[model samples]
Target: MKKFFSISFVLLLALSGILAGCGSDEAGGEAGKKIKIVAAHNQTSPDNPYQTGLLEFKEVAESKSNGDIEVEVHAGTIGTEESELVEKLKLGAADVVLVSPGFMTQTGIKEIDLLAMPYLFDNYEHWEKTVDGEVGEEMAKLINEKSNNDFKLIGYWSAGVRHYYGKKPLEKMEDMKGLTFRTQTSGVVADYWKKVGAIPTSIAWGELYQALQQNVVDSSENSYPYFVQQNHHKTDNGKYITETAHDYTTRFLLVNGKKFDSYSKEQQDIIIEAAEASVKAEREAVYAQEDEYKEKAIDDGAKVNEIDREPFIKLAEPLQEKAAKDMGAEDLLEKIRNLK
Candidate 1:
């Protein structure tokens, strides 16, 4: 009887130990699992610049982390409107996003608008130096501070130079007078157009095509690739492509601060490195497509003109000064101008 009781007690002890071991293993497994990060963008799959960056980030991050992190791109899957994406990031519904500077400026971080100021950058080299240098660092710091650490601007990706596309050829600023042009609903852009005597009509991008087709808006401005890819030239009958180069726009990739903070140091470093690589790849893709798209536009019977930029610059300088004052971004603008 004594031996039987002893054996039973030992059996119960062993079972309890086994159960505890299993529970611990399950907990550790759950803790050790790879993190899944979702990145959202305004462009649809396989068609947006965000697509290339998304792939690059995923490839680099997964490889560097050895499958400890997974990045899934929710391209155009989150929201089409830039403002909506920004709001989603703030609410923690989205982990990361790729959005335009114009949209970011509207969030009360107006210093970013300096990037959209007309002709602030002479070429890609100038733009890159400013973005990757001290000026960019300062701007990033300000953005993070302004957002109360809800959003962090990780890096910038270029959208190329913007130009005017109209139904009739515009040879000078005077020709743009009283012309109804579709503009982003940004005071900075609208005010700039107003200064040049163009009627700035606000329109959402998704509705722009139909609006142009039905003659609701007579003209618009965007990069060559955007103009071609969006088929803006097709709907705007008698398309006139002018080389106004009004703004060198850039898109920002933002990360939710809390989500970013949740990552380990190693994981954070991996994300940053991946973003840098993706930015480089994206810039190369953009440069290659710029001329290719311009050629396509010409082939499609769109008249392309290489206009004299001096006249446009003269008209824009005073407006630039005014914008800098209104947005309180003059110091950053000066720093950008000094970048090599």
Candidate 2:
């Protein structure tokens, strides 16, 4: 009887040890466990800058962690809309996501809308200086705090420079009068277009090709890589290209802050490094693709023209001031302007 009791106690101890080991693994113990990250972007094009950026992130993260951290990049796989991506990230369905300022504002981070203001940035050099500097840091902090750490801004990305394309070319600001423009129909972007005498209209990015082809909208605006890849310039309503040079665009690369905090310090470090690499790779891709796609559009018979931008700049200034004051980002606006 004594021998039997001793054996039973020993078995109980072993069972407890096994349960504890399982608990540790479940609690993010690095031993014998691999971390999986779901990184996503809305653009589905294989040659897209977003894809290049996220893949670079995957490579750096996996290689640096020696395969301990596995990054699975989904390009329009899990979510094709920025809104969907933002929702997934907040719900913990996605670990990392790329989103635009317009959608980010929809998530209750209104300060981000500042980045989407038309004519806010003069050129890519000015944009890089602002976002990689103090203004960017402030914005990131605001995002993390405003979202209660649900979002952590990991990096800033560009969607290249936006231009105007439509059925007809604009020789001056007055030419935009009475034109139905496809663009953000809300916020400062809409206000700017309206002030310039164009009627702002909202359309989904996916449906835009059909809209352009069918002449459902009279005109639209976007960067070269984006509209060109969609063959927008080939459409009857999209054949004319004017270098409006509005919106040196900005995209946010975000990770779930709560999830980031839960990771081991080493894992967090690897993620930051990966983000840095992605920013570099993505920007280079956009710059190169912009020139390539612009040339492609011209070769395909898309009319290309350049106009004096002083009129557009003049129109955007008052709106910028009013928007900055309303958002309580007057100081940030001043800083961005000073950079320019």
Candidate 3:
């Protein structure tokens, strides 16, 4: 598997070079020429919030610009992996894409990972307050400047709130002890789960169904819409869900900054306006899906239980502080904490 992944990375690198060379040498030139922005996301599901958001962007931009701007949206057709999509964005093969902060951190700007830290927000409101506020602005600046303006964060979206689903319900923190839980294998997520006595196991998103079915991992965590959409609730090991709500997942709608810089001032304003619409549409879709999917999970014979998440939140504070300090975002973390 390691060897396969290594080869995939090499091929993607080669593809990035080819894509960079294939595009017009001048990206943001000649405003009158019909400009096509290739927007992509790795999610194949048409109902996904990412697709909804990207389609909103396409519709608003094309209509408002009167076809001066053509937005071609691809759902998992261009690249089925976010890493590849990010590479395409930098190379100008893809003009815009969605990604989590964890992937952003891999670009060598550690501060972006601050948003991915679990339990940082008390709820969706607190999460929004931080990301839609000065912290979000500062992080956007950091991402653009650090990537040499390769990435411009246009908007923030959510994957709803994440909770735990497993073969058994976690009634208390001690219930996680000795169970192998599939989650992020490194960073603050793993640290928090590990401190709770659950072993953190890394599994590819695509392979998680089989992993859970075969008991390769005893438990896993994700938002209601995501796991239920995948039919994970039907699996033997995925039937019991605990509302940990440990994370209010954040995703970034990012465009190629250098390419965006090349656009006419009017074009830039329209694109930003479209992004605002996309953000609103995406959040509404996700919030609605959370309740819809949770009900569907119950109707499908999957059990749901609520936990007193206060203890979990307490456990996360020190972890959040450590993560922020490590990433040099102590003040930003404090700001997020106070927003609650």
Candidate 4:
């Protein structure tokens, strides 16, 4: 009876070892098994720059892996809400996503909001220097650390520089006084406009056209590509576009860091390559679209004016400093300012 029991225990141990090996084989570097990723962003437009970047990622990953890895790009089909995507990433339902700093703050990483401060970058050149350099690397590290490795910043992209468009063009700082300006929901953006004497109002991006048509908000700020694509210029309250150039925006391409770490080393390297390619493609798309849409807006009769940006920059300094201190990113802010 003792000999029979020993034989049965040996068989069970052998079987468990085989099963564990099978599990690893099925997950990585195995025949007939592939890693699939769901990549998503909240831009609904088929031609949006986010789509351009994500599609490139899918293309590169699939081509490099020779069918070992497949990426599915969901352009707002998965979720139009950045918040929803962030939640899905945490739940392991989504693999990759794009998000702005404001929405990122909702994840409890308020230090990221410093990127959204007014006059953060002097121009696209200064903007590129900051975000493509050491400052960007540190910010990416903070995101991953704060999220407990739930979020990994793969690459940085741009949404073009933001400008002010409203009922009338501003020739001086005093023009902003008393105007109801449509801006971000909160954070340093709203505060900056408020300091300039404009009453900052929050309006949903999709609902903004009607709000402007009905005078719910007298003015709004955005890049030419965004506002022109939505025809914000056609509205009576949006005809005059002033080049305030307050923000040179940054968007992050993030992946589920834990999921990323779970990937095989070869697969992880392939994904990093794909992300680098996508970043280049996305930035090129945004820069081209900025000029293309600006011309379109001008042809569509949206009056464009250049404001003296010096006073506005001066107004933004104290506000930027306060916001940086509040977010505990004062050093990061100083690095960015010095980058310009």
Candidate 5:
């Protein structure tokens, strides 16, 4: 009887130890569970390229991880302006954000602003070559260094080229004279518009339609897709399209340095792969839709004109020279110009 009791006690002790070990393992596994990421953008819907790319990222990240990671999109919910978005990204309030190169000027990478200079590229191919080549890599490196390890640029997505639209047909730069044109608050953009003899007026994108309806502004410039998507053509306040192609706007997919560092090496690789895939998909989509949007604008009563691009290009020469001398972007501009 004594032996039986001793043996039973020993067995109970072993069983308890096994159960305790299992509990610890379960707890550790739970603690090590999936990583969650939030991607923020100014896009309000999935229809836009920025939002679509982010959605693709979410799908690829989650699907590829087999449920080990999750990405939530905070489109147009975090902030309305680019500056605000950058601030949120730096403060770590946002894990990821889609920002324009224009905003990088504040970080001492003023050279990026020169990319927005009017009529910089002769065609989309030239634009792509410059961005995908050494110049783009250098700019990215400069941005990373200037950011002080707060943000990492994952990829660049197209915002397309901006063209002018107005109520009256503008056949030449002189036709833009005295027109109250809606302009971004960018000093370079404002100066460009001023030099072209138009009155540059600053208006938030959300308020543009109302501003147009009330005759607050007579004209604006943007990519054809944006103009079409925003229903600016329907306003009937403007019907002329100029082939100015002033800016080849681009947005960056940036990640929080701290949040990215927390992920395992395998997880980081997966996220970057997903981001690159989404960027390729987005570029294809934008190029496919570019002409479609232009046709749609014409069908909707907007008069499309293929003006002499050379004159506008010549007009922009002074601005480029001024930017080179005063803005310290001459080297970057020269690099882009030298690209074959």
Candidate 6:
């Protein structure tokens, strides 16, 4: 009887060890589960600054996660429109996205339109000060709250300073009259353009090259790197570039806030760090490419000219002030101007 009892006791100990091994494996698997992130931007060009910025994000995120995180970046693959990206982001289809203020405003976040106002920023210095300071923090908090945690602003990115490029150069304020300009169709930007006498027309970014080639639009405005890289200068309606310096454009690097909240504290810290790195890399790329592409445009026979921007700035200021008040952003507007 004693011998039988000893054998049963040994079996019981072995069973307990087996169960403990299974528990350890289950916990290990849960802790080491691989996470996948889908990062996307609207620009398709591999040489574009958007690509540069996102690539930096991917590198930083993956490296910091030690192979537990995988980032799949889609540059106009999943969607070419900012609206589409924003929609996907809200639905949790996209993990991270890049979008401009105008498109973001269409998602019912009109307060963001303040960033899209023409002549709102005088230069890159003013822009950096506004977006990297307390004003930016307030805007970010507003976005998070307004979005109900659907969107979280990771960083502010620049599309560089926008200038006017079209079939004809604007020598003066009157030169814009009657021009069918391809630009934002709504918000303060379109209002400012119309007030300056250019009839604003909506054109998709990918379609603008064809529109310019076919004379569907008489004029368009953008930064040098954007239009020049698309070979817009080669189009019949895109040869003349006037340095209006109208908008120092702002883009938002956003993550799905709910998904972000679901991540471990370590993962969230890594993502924020990655976003900071991306912001720096992207701005540097845009600054460098602006000079590079401007030279390229000139060398490629695009006529470049400078106009008296004071008139445009004068036309834009009242609109900016009124729009700021309408959106309850009067203080934010004052803050922006003070930064200048």
lDDT scores of the candidates, listed in order: 0.75, 0.85, 0.82, 0.82, 0.72, 0.84
How high is each candidate's TM-score?
A: 0.87, 0.90, 0.89, 0.87, 0.85, 0.90
Q: Please list all clashing residue pairs in model 6, or write none if there are none.
A: none
Provide C-alpha RMSD values for all models, in order: 15.1, 13.2, 8.8, 12.6, 15.3, 14.7
Q: Is candidate 1 or candidate 5 better by TM-score?
A: 1
lDDT string, candidate 4, 1-340, tens digits: 0000111232233223322332343453444347999999987777788899999999999999897899999998888777889999989999999988988998999999988888888777777777667777777778877898899888887888899999999999899999999877578887888889999887777688999999999999988877888889999999999998888899988888777766765676678778878887887888889889989988998999998999999989998898889888999998988876
Best by lDDT: 2
* Residue 50, model 6, lDDT: 94
150-188 in candidate 1: lDDT tens per residue? 887777788878899988878877888988988864567
Q: What is the lDDT of residue 288 in candidate 4?
A: 87
Report RMSD for candidate 5: 15.3
Candidate 5 matches the true fold with a TM-score of: 0.85
Point out the higher-scoring one by lDDT: 1 or 3. Answer: 3
Better TM-score candidate (2, 4): 2
In angstroms, how far off is 158's CA in candidate 1? 0.3
lDDT of 1: 0.75
Pairs with backbone N, CA or C atoms under 3 Å apart (clashes), candidate 1: none
Backbone collision count in every prediction? 0, 0, 0, 0, 0, 0
